[model samples]
Target: MSVRPLTEDQRDAMQEITNIAMGQAGSLLATLLGVFVNLSVPRINVLALSDVADAIGSMVGRNIEITAVRQSFHGYLRGEAIVIYGRDGCKELGDLMGYDEVLDRTDEIELLLDVSNILVGACLGGIIDQIKGITEAHGAGELSFSAPSLMAENVPAEVLINPDKLTWTHALLMEVNFTLEGRNFISHLCMLMPGGSIEKMRNILDEFVASF
Candidate 1:
């Protein structure tokens, strides 16, 4: 399928859907941390595979050391979701999660994976629920996701979805930032759906908007 840029209406609709999903995720994090969680408004974009690295650099900074956890989802739609954090942010997050000891590489990895599971699970669950509701209203099948995995240290953003094996040349990218109040911790959560899924997603969003 040929990839096309999303229309203004489609972009807006997708952003709205993502905002709702991230809000749900943020609420879960807040409850778990016993602190207020601030979530950025979701940003939706369509870009070629080669541009993904630049896109991530713009969000997390080019010089910062980073860690990421990736989880792939399949079913009605297929894609990967990544949660990224800077080195300092990772340490702060561990501290917030009740890990006060000096963390070695192993300890840090364990903490990162735990946090990733909670945040990614909540966010993906919210997104899937929205997709199911929209698709069911239009008589379409539902979607599901696999387990989340911790990627190697400082994994490049472009590798989050392997372009060589991808069925589509472009991806629909959704990103949101999460920050904790009175702390220096911040993380970016991104979801990438194959270019092929955009048309179907747009149709569902169109019907969803018409109902609103």
Candidate 2:
């Protein structure tokens, strides 16, 4: 049997679910960071893998540190989950941490790592646990990064720029943003699979949403 492409209704439905997930994440961030977290409208983008590089570059800007945290979940959906934070976003997070001394360049970077780790971990942890029905199953994994220069040496993920030539083979790419202090930030992104495993995740979420 062939899996059908997501209809507009299906896409909207998924977006709503993502909104709920991000709302929970926002609440967690507010509590953890001791400042209010504001979420913008949930924007959904489906793109080619190659175009992702350019899309990231345009959104995050060039000459910025990009830190990423990844976690893999099984049962409902099986794919690499990633949360990326830009350099400015990290700096704002450091200030929120209430460091006494002015953050030097090194201190800024280190504080950003800590902020990235906690915020990304909490955001993803909440969403995955709610979707999977097992709070304990969602565990944290080590985060890694590729230098911005390496992106050119590696694959170009600029999907939005060249939508026509790009293929949408992936199931879904959900992105949400968070603005803290004066900086614009993309808080969390989830790439969900459309394979057999998707049924498990969809069914569970469907029931959860229907109940409300």
Candidate 3:
């Protein structure tokens, strides 16, 4: 389905809500690892699925390979959340939590999935909870998540988000990256909602702004 883009007011409202959600995810990670989390201002875009790679690459770099985790969420607003970890992102995570040695292949994937799953649940649930409070439009629905699994492994950034494989045509993309101060670790949390859900979000955002 083709949908018109969100107006500037709607986009700004989305950016602000996404920022809060991002911070919630970051705070969870910081608490888990005992390290500070640096977050970027969240960006909200209504983009074609084919344009998603470019959007992701600009944030995490196209040349480097990434480790990613993917999970699906269902509720008032539905979408998939993909967490992209930089080349050394997982390694840095291991070090931060006091791992004495490099993790084995299975151990690495397990760790990656676990952390990303928690983050996806926190970030997406945060937005849904806040939006529902602001707008009763979707308040009746319950939020839930599927298991997070590996999406890409040492894969080039360009092919990580394969639009051709996705069934949706367009998405409302909200993205933010988390970094450790003075560390090479970087991970981007990207949430994409289909065109159908965008309509609900538009209304929710309007309600959110009016509530202020």
Local distance difference test values of all predictions, in order: 0.78, 0.52, 0.85
Candidate 1 per-residue lDDT over residues 1-212, each given as its tens digit: 34577888888888887888889889988887878999898888888876766787787767666788888887767888888987787778667778778788778877777777888788877776776777776665656667667764775544444556665678888899899999988889988887667777888778777877
In model 2, the worst 10-residue window by lDDT is 146-155
How much is the lDDT of residue 34 in candidate 1? 79
Taking all chains together, each candidate's TM-score versus the true structure is: 0.89, 0.61, 0.94
Which portions of model 1 miss their true places by more than 4 Å? Answer: 1-3, 137-139, 155-167
lDDT of candidate 2 over 1-212, digit per residue (tens)? 23444555545666776677777777777786787778766655544444445555565455655655444444435544555665455556666777666778666656544554554455555555455543234442322322211111112223212335434343445666666645455444444343453444455545556556
Q: Order the candidates by lDDT, highest first.
A: 3, 1, 2
Candidate 3 CA-lDDT value = 0.85
Question: Worst ten-residue run, lDDT, model 3?
Answer: 134-143
Q: Taking the candidates one at a time, how many backbone clashes does each contain?
A: 0, 9, 0
Top-lDDT candidate index: 3
Pairwise TM-score winner, candidates 1 and 3: 3
- Name the runs in model 2 displaced over 4 angstroms: 1-4, 54-65, 102-114, 117-122, 125-171, 183-212
Question: Which of 1 and 2 is ahead in lDDT?
Answer: 1
TM-score ranking of the models: 3, 1, 2
- How far out, in Å, is residue 164 in model 1? 4.7
